[model samples]
Target: MSILKRDQGGVPRADPLGDAAGTTALVLALNKPVYPVYVWFLAESAFQLSLLTALSMPLYLVVWYVSRIGNSRAARLGLVIVGVLDTLAIALIFGRESETLAFLFACLVLSGFAFYRCEVWLSRGLVAAIFFLFVLAESLIGGPLTPITAGDMQNLAYLNITGAAALVAFIALRFPRQERMG
Candidate 1:
């Protein structure tokens, strides 16, 4: 089924602004890596950041777009996998002391949103589980907790922002399915 399709009653439903608002809030809440990325992109040469963003964002979006429209079990599993990878990336990027606060905040916000909005308990549980798993894994990896340097920020920023996008898309795909069924 197309992600755009309406209910069986054939009545077109207005788009919920809450979803957009939630997505924006989620994106904005994850400011730790994003702020640094933006600064790095501005402070240093823009070529690499620009190039990476252009190349990566579209590919990520396409995966999300396809996942939204495709009901195949594989697509659903893929969203879960992407969701896991995104959180893992966040943990790796923000494992330091100064950044850890932001990381914890982002994780709380994302998981809380998922818990509140996701109709399926399975989805909610999966999100929560993966988040804690990554946190624990990062702790076990045992790197010194320090602030991100400008050089590290560049790559981390890309990962953080794009990961947010992927996370949004993953939720979008999962949450809408319950509405359609009901």
Candidate 2:
């Protein structure tokens, strides 16, 4: 019951993008956990991080795809395509070196698109995909930008928490009240 209207087939046409303010808030919120994970990965080895990413990403995609089966065929198909692209992007982020930051930035941009344009499940799924990709990439790419100091870690945490709070508030305002009430 968002700003969406139905098509001639009686299908609920989805929003072309998400609410601008809401998606922006969600992006900030979703990007929070990357700092700590990046820090932890830097403390560890890139090999371990990549291995972890390679293992976990496929599992997550499978789970996410399975969970979306109840949706309409078109929606499910769209989710699968996005999920596959996301998986490939994640693999590239983990597989390559010195490009984690770039990939993370790209994923975040996609996250913004997902939040604004896609359905709720797709929006949420895209965020999850971005988080894992960023974490894996951050872990592999060790450099000046990577969080090393305690202060940097703390600052990242602070930003993430603030973003999360804002995201929650915006989500509350953005979605239909009846959906939640039901």
Candidate 3:
């Protein structure tokens, strides 16, 4: 059966927002493992940071699984929470010098708004949470948990930029096309 079709439980499984979130989570899970290679030559702390990121794979996988089980709302929320927490952790570790916060947070905000099309309050709340976290990490707690070389930071920035861009593209592509009104 097609993924978009109803499951045995009669739950609809074709939620565009959920699909986008789930796909994003799956993509992140697949890529997290490769992060270490991106900064292999960096300081041990940097390598350790990359390894820590890889540990979030399971969370992402869970989001995907939830989405597949016809719990799109929960899956979308899971994706948002995971993304927010993961970014916060990285931001705390890399501090203000982490060049990827803007892109990452932008993606999170986009997802937050897109995922709750019918629930205005939920959408606003999600965006507020993302913004609050961004400010807290970028302004209030802008100090690295572990020191990293400039070169290592640059490499990580590149990785994050690529990942964020890919996620944005995926969300856009997965968005349901609306029929134009006459």
Candidate 4:
């Protein structure tokens, strides 16, 4: 009886996007560290600025690629390729100016793949951990490579980690779910 009434329904319905318990919270957390640093100083050096852009832009592109590819496994494989390149790139960033950042660019592309494949906290955590080390390395030893300002580097780290987290969240929410397709 009451079941047929539109106005008097019980639980009614749930909104999926709103159900994202922590999307706004997480996005806020991710954006925090970078904004203040922006006020402190601009990007330290051409090299560091290049490094951040090199890492982020390619990733954004590759994610678009993964979406078109549509198969999750295929996307995972792409991520693997990107990961391998990233490993090589990190080595080069410290090792030499020309090759290092380029290779790291490849790695960021793979990160998109990880975002596509991973759907939970631990998966995202692994990516975050790697990023933490990546930034810490840039801070502690990067001065040897070229002149970059400390404030710039801090901002870079904030942007990188937060951006990466945001990437994972976007991937989780927007990806096509076959289960939901029907």
Please write out the lDDT profile of model 2 over residues 1-182, one tens digit for every residue: 54557556433444222223223323333443453365354433332333333343443344334434433333333433443454345334333333333334433443434332324565566668767755765566444322234554344334434543554455445544432212
Q: What's the best-to-worst order under TM-score?
A: 3, 1, 4, 2
TM-score of each: 0.41, 0.32, 0.78, 0.38
Model 2 score (lDDT): 0.41
Q: Give the root-mean-square deviation of each candidate in angstroms.
A: 8.7, 12.1, 4.8, 11.7
lDDT of candidate 3 over 15-121, digit per residue (tens):
67667667777887887787677657543457776677677789989999998886787887888788877776766666666555755565455554455334556
Residue 104 in model 1: shift from native, Å?
7.4
- Backbone clash tally (model 3): 0
Strongest candidate by TM-score = 3
User: Which stretches in model 4 have alpha-carbon errors above 4 Å?
Assistant: 1-41, 47-72, 87-144, 176-182
- Runs in model 2 with CA error above 4 Å? 1-5, 9-128, 131-135, 141-143, 146-149, 177-182
Residue 22, candidate 3: how far off, in angstroms? 1.7
Task: Give candidate 1 misplaced runs (Cα > 4 Å).
Answer: 1-37, 41-59, 67-80, 93-95, 98-119, 141-182
Clashing pairs in 3: none
Judging by TM-score, tell me the better candidate of 2 and 3: 3
**Stronger candidate by TM-score (1 vs 2):** 1
Q: Report lDDT (CA) for all predictions.
A: 0.42, 0.41, 0.67, 0.40
Model 4, 51-70: lDDT tens digits are 43245335424533543444
Q: Which ten residues in a row have the lowest lDDT in candidate 3?
A: 173-182
